[model samples]
Target: MSLLFCEVISAQQSLPKIHKDEVDFVNPLIGTAITGFAKGLDGGGTMPCVNVPFAMTNFVAQTGESKMGRMCYQYEDKAVIGLLATHQPTVWMGDYGYVSIMPQTGSLRVLPKERRLTYDHKDEIAKPYYYSVKLKADAKTSIKAEIAGANTCGMFRFTFPAAEKAHLIIQGINLNPELTDWANDYKSRLKRLKGYVHIDTVNNEITGYNPDRQSAQLGPELKNFKGYFIIKFDKQIRKYGTWDNKIIKKGSEEQFGTRMGAFISFKTLANTQIKVAVATSFISLDQARSNLKKEIPDWDFEKIVKDTRNNWQQQLKVAQVNGVTNEQKTIFYTALFHTLLFPRQFSEYGRYYSAFDDKIHNGESYNDYSLWDTFRALHPLLILTQPERINGMVKSLLQMYQEGGWMPMWPNPTYTNIMISTHADAVVADAYVKGFRGYSTKLAYDAMHKDAFEAPDGDMQKKWGDRDLWTSYEARGGLTYYHKLGFVPVDKVRESVSRTIEYGIDDYCVAQVAKSLGKTEDYNELMKWSANYKNVYNPATGFMAPKNVNGQWSAKPDSGFTEGTKWTYTFGAMQDIPGMISLMGGEKPFADKLKHNFNDGHYRADNEPGHHYIYLFNYCGMPWKAQELVRQHTGWQNFRNAPIGINGNDDCGQTSAWYIFSTMGFYPVTPASGLYSIGAPQFPYIALNLQNGNKLVIKAIDLSAQNKYVKEVRFDGQLIKNHIISHEQISHGGTLEFKMTSVPQKD
Candidate 1:
């Protein structure tokens, strides 16, 4: 048995029992504050979104006024433009399919800036499924608005001060006009960039269409891209009209032009409430109405909010941890909340509109993949907590391949071709290996194999193939020389080192699936190719350097690496850590280098490449070092309830997943490997409710901020001789106890 896990006395003491609801810790504002790194951008850019788990659409208050301001609802901003139904995954990528609505008591303004109202943040209420704010449009009028939504439908209730011309305006904003040539040519842009709004004064409703002109990137597969919506109001409409180009034409039922929208005015007494229900569909206007009817048949604002909260509570109940501070619980649950937001449900009812085929398909379809970011930790966390959801996600990816002829790289309601490498390979393989096989494994393997072996071609290449079918290998830009040179030459690609390392991990994933399917030749070949990351290692500089096509390292070696530095890529060889340590001259030397990297601030916790580096200490036979590093990084980089709490973009919850795993005292360094590298638990106890009708409990005795080192570890009373635990052991369910101390435990 390893001396690190030698038998030690367990401390016995009765601790305070913390219930699930007692925490009330899912603060949407925890990561909302802007930070230094994300300054002027979405600093700590987490959306204070109000939606159900995996809902197709989310409602957030739009506060910023600039073009880049669309990315964040800065807490410091004093004005509220309106509320929007947005599909904004991160501030960096911007938003799509956006529809804005504002309530006013006096004269109506067509533009967002003119109609913006000042609101106090202290009076605002934000919850998982509900958001409310009191906005003052002028000196005499104040509008209290509350919102809630489920699936493809949402509702808004507004209390208006008694006024003669109380009105509600609905507008569609052109989020991405750069995709069209209209930006350069004003006349052509105005003529081509058009939307439609039709008002029904008799039915007190408004219907419109917003076409996504950014289809140049979706290729021939996307026949048409449009979002249709139907909004019904509860109050009687005294007057209605349409607006175009900042001109309001009263009593006009229809309008078609750039910057088009509709408004409905009503006369109401003091404290009179107005309710609005809206449904959106990519299929047609009729489908949008049907969605509104099915999801929310009546004007019950409170019921929707209550139901949405219950829905979030049910999902949040999967893992319950006790004996943590209120602030710690807040951070943990908020991180978990962000992880469940993406890979959103794009399909409504039994029908889904595919950007790949430009046809409405009958089934559940999910979009907003962000695979390069989510595949690392988010998908793996879902595999453990929400296996059934993972099954659906796998099926969704395979369906995309069947429709588009290639798997998605980073899908935002369509094949975006954003980021690098086909990481859908890793997500699918990880699910299959973790025993979630509701999807077709054979079909998945075929997709993964095609992405790995096939050359860049029409609508199938790595980047921008979705938009331009004729995009060349050089234009696609990610390890294009992999087949010929066995490694991505820095001279040939932009992010050459990042491409090689990420591709190596993707290759390892495909090998796992191939081996499971009994393809011995392919498995062995891929396994060999997976080790190609070592080719980029430069022992001279002790960093992963870029090499030329002729196999010669760069003279100065570009310091401005891909999204990171050369030091970040040095530990990118995650598949072969033992070999990586050997290349650095053995365990002791590797440990010393890692220490210098962390102590000297070379190990970045802000990006994805170095996410698994802190856990690499486990592979070097120094579990104690891994424990302290986890604690230090978690403390420094993460926060409890501040807006700028997170150091970087959530990356669709990958950053949060690191926190969830590290706080739980283990992390999956190699996600699909099914092994979790052990660390020190932050809490005294954590109970995860498994889907298999079992509970996995973790207990840490004498656990405190100072006592971050693990003195001894045991699983269900048996000593854990190794610094690792398997998925089978955790999922089967049992107690894992840890003894902690201020001093490190020597092996």
Candidate 2:
């Protein structure tokens, strides 16, 4: 046997078994603290979301208020108003189709502010599936609230102190009122917000539907969309009533125009615990009731919480790490938890409603595709760990294309053309080349081809028109300019350089799929256009500057980058790193520029564009530098079980996905390349259980904080001569061993 094999076997046997429940390591409150950063821009703008993996409904406690308050659960808030059924992707985009539930005593205050109760952080507990908080209304009355849920149904258990008047108020309001108003102004349309609530006193149940008036923020297609929900309680109602616009009405049910809700008041003894089950649907109230019956029929709160925890545990067991500090495990598992929270399941049972088509369909559907952000890492991570889920995602995307005409960029249960480019092309093409066959490849290719070549007109044009709020670069944002001028013009587009570079990457991904599918002509055509990023390269400035239609460079070259500087976008050509390096006159210049980016504070780890910049050193033949930078970024900018752990918005789990890939000792620099750039591994041992019944085990010898650099790397008893590994090698399952040392390996 080889000496390396013997050493690996000995190490594997010596390591402790990972019997600690993975769910215990996940701290949902790690990123929920409110920092001074911009509302959506805050890196810690995450909620203690309690739900099943990718479940359509998330149960979270609301703390603070903001113009864009999607992440309403802030750690620093002195009090929590209510627990809400939220479909919020992030604070930047805002939430939709949500209702609030608050438990109050002593008096019946309908407004949120009057009913808000103070809470201490020490009295709160948060996990992937369960969350609990102690609410103190006054010196005399206190309430203990806990929440847990399945796919579409949530269970809320509240323990109240003995009181004369104990009430549970259920209200529906616009979560993002300011953003909706802003959208109304931009679209020049004021759609009335409609809400309805019907109460059944005999059954002790309340059912309603709230139609969120579409705003320019969500595009025109989603205007006046509605979502229905059914709420049932276990405790008997001593008295039942309703309220409209804070006006007290002694009745069983009431429906109001814009601001309306229903409440139930009952007398309870001390330590009386009441449980409520809430089920929601995009289809109708009856479907909501059916979902509730199918998902959570009984009031077994403890069983539901246990089952939810076990579900998260099973999902998290896909990758098991050992020999790391407790802090590192917390960060690792928390990131893994965040990565699974988005692109949620939109279908309920066997039925779904598509806001894109304004019709009901009979099948499973997925929504919240933050493709512009997730195509980089989140989707690729799923392709490696959860290929079956990726298959479902691809099938869902293709179905949306069939119904809506164009593939989605971002969809909050509907197509919301919010971000920069059509990167769904990259996601579909990546999944296809990676051999995920849940959908029709021919249909996917046809859809991508049409999106790439054709222009929008008629209804399609109207849908694409809302995307022109920021830039009028083209009807579909720079497709015309990219075809005609080889690059998008800064004078015409809002974020010209960012769109051009991203489109080039997307084209490269499409070309890969075309080549694999035997479309020689299409492959050659897309490959030529993939080099269009070269046209925007500014030789003298050492940056990817934007150019006008006249081929003149923008005098203010940095003006075209999105949410970042010129230096940030300069290193964004992940599809062609060698080409990018050669444009800057070779390896030494490229390495120097990268170092300067970090030294001069040009590299922003808080955003999407600069995520892969640290790993670029491996392509420059200096993996040691990449190792140093990874440690620096992970230690300094990332989390350590604190509220401000994440340095940027979760962005539908893209930021956390970066942390997961980096800590696992590699990252997918190019989404479609099937290649991972090796970096420093945070854990000494990692076992990733692939869906194909294979296990990829990664072990680091003598790994510690100081010994972060890799001295030697071997795969399956053979030495890896380079600093790159392929997805096929990892997915097929084998042992990858890394020898660690404090000193750098100059050779």
Highest TM-score, which number? 2
Candidate 2 pairs with clashing backbones: 43-648, 639-645
As for candidate 1, its clashing pairs are 33-643, 33-644, 217-467
> Tens digit of lDDT per residue, candidate 2, span 1-747?
322223333554554466678888899988887672434446567789899999998998887533344367877789988888888767766566777789999889877777899999999999888999999967967899899978888999999999888999988654333444443332332244667787887787888887753323455545436778888889876576777665777765766545568888988799999998998888888889899888887988888899999999989989898765556677889989999888999988888888678788998788988887899889988886777788788888888888877788777666665767778898998887777777898999987887666654431223233334422212247577778889888776668888788888888888898889899999898888888889999998888998887899988877777778888799998999999999999999999999999999777788899899999999887899998887777764555578877887778889888888887788989977878888877677899898779998988888765677899898898888778888888889899898999998878
Q: Model 1: per-residue lDDT, tens digit, 543-585?
A: 8888877899977586316677888888887777888899999
Worst 10 residues of 1 by lDDT: 2-11
> Candidate 2 at residue 132, lDDT?
96
- Model 2 ranges with Cα > 4 A deviation: 1-19, 36-41, 65-70, 175-190, 213-216, 457-476
Question: What lDDT does the true structure give each of the candidates?
Answer: 0.76, 0.79
Provide the TM-score for each candidate, comma-separated: 0.92, 0.93
lDDT of 1 at 379: 87
Over the full model, what C-alpha lDDT does candidate 2 score relative to the true structure? Answer: 0.79
